[model samples]
Target: MLQHPKYIVRRLQPADAPSFYAAVRESVDELTYWMPWCSKDYSLSDAEAWMQSTSDMWAAGAEFPLGIFDATTGEVLGGTGVNHINRAYRIGNIGYWVSSKRTGQGIARFAAHESAVLGFGELGLTRLEIVVLTHNRASQRVAETVGAKLECEARNRLYFQGSPHSAFVYSLVPEDVR
Candidate 1:
């Protein structure tokens, strides 16, 4: 588990299902726009399945999806991860999202930076990428705030919700952090 001054970043547990579902449900409108898997029809069963998938991925060292929680109250805040790993190249993707009500509170920025630290320090990744859909200004800002250099705008970099998207690709190296 990783700790921040006001939050904790850790692996999901079975008990987190209820809170996870609530978080997703509360942010479904915003989340569905970018995260295709989360739709208006998202249910508690979906959260359970997601946790199971994340557990399997963690065991395989394929992807690491962690939940961010309030340090004091243990409330589910959001999620961040070092996923889409290319182990041979020591490269991975760092991504994060926060509750809509918590946006503009620097939570996403912390999650972004911490995830990069996890990528470099724990995952031993030499390079990390933050790919934000071109239209996602808030996420782009978080990537920039964490010192992930804007590399380029890549066409068709992501296929989500059954469509191709142009994305702003950012890169972060170990030196990018203190």
Candidate 2:
């Protein structure tokens, strides 16, 4: 787990389903815009299943999905993680999202940075990537804040609700974080 003055970052647990569900429910509209898995019908069961899947992935060393929480209140802030891990290449992709109310608070930036630290420091990863939808300026800003370089733009790189979207690919190496 990673701790910061304003928030705590950690792996998801089954017990977190309720709060996670609530957070998603509150921001479903905004989240559905970019998150393929998010929808108006998302349920607590889905959150629990997601938590279970994340746990399994962690055990298999395939991916890490972390939850960000309010440091003091323990409220679910959002999530960030290193996914699509490619062990052979020592590379992983970083992704993050915050509740609508938490936007503009720097929470996403902090969580993203911490995820990079975990990826490069603990996971022995050599490179990290952040893919942002072309229209997602907020996410692009987070990648920039963490020193990720704009690598290129790809067409139909991200899929949301079964449709492809163009995205800007940003990359960060260990030295970029340092």
Candidate 3:
């Protein structure tokens, strides 16, 4: 795991599942407003399964799943990943969330910025996109902080938590990176 003063963002391990489960449990209620999946019951079993798939994807060069950790306490804060990768198009998508307690401390912004640098510089991707719920202004601000632009909105983009929701598409091209 990489250590920063405020947080650590690194590749996830199966061992982190317990903490991940606990973090999600604590944050579920607050997260459910804009993040649809947080309403469901979160168990270690599901976390383990998700970690297994994340490990496999990392092994296959198809994904990079990262867990954010608190630096001083070494607690798992939350998870994020690069998904929907298209090698031919030289593009990928960034998805992320922070634990409730850590929300306003810029952990998600640091993680997202690091991920974007990796995606563009290391992975040689030309474009990176983020799809966030329209109501998620905090996340939107993070995107803008990283220099991502507001693209088109995906109308009725997701059937989330039993309701149709629109998503704001944001993107960063290679030129947008430092």
Q: Write candidate 2's Cα lDDT for 43-102 as tens digits.
A: 999999999998998898889899999999888889999999889999999999999988
Worst ten-residue run, lDDT, model 1?
1-10
Instruction: Provide the global lDDT of candidate 2 against the true structure.
Output: 0.92
lDDT tens per residue, model 3, 1-178 = 3467878888888888888888888888776765655565767787788789889999899998888888887788987768789999999998889888878888888888778877887788999998888887998999999899999889998667788889999999988877
**Model 3 accuracy (lDDT, Cα):** 0.83
Lowest summed lDDT across 10 adjacent residues in model 2 is found at 157-166
Q: Which residue pairs come into collision in candidate 3?
A: none
The models' CA-based lDDT, in order, is 0.89, 0.92, 0.83
Candidate 1 residue-wise lDDT, 5-116, digit = tens: 8988888887888888888999999999888678899999999998898899889999999888888988888999999999899999998989888889888888888888
Candidate 1: C-alpha lDDT: 0.89
**Per-candidate TM-score against the hidden true structure:** 0.96, 0.95, 0.89
Ranking by TM-score: 1, 2, 3
Q: Which stretches of candidate 2 lie above 4 Å from their native place?
A: none
Query: Where in model 3 is the C-alpha error above 4 Å?
Result: 33-39
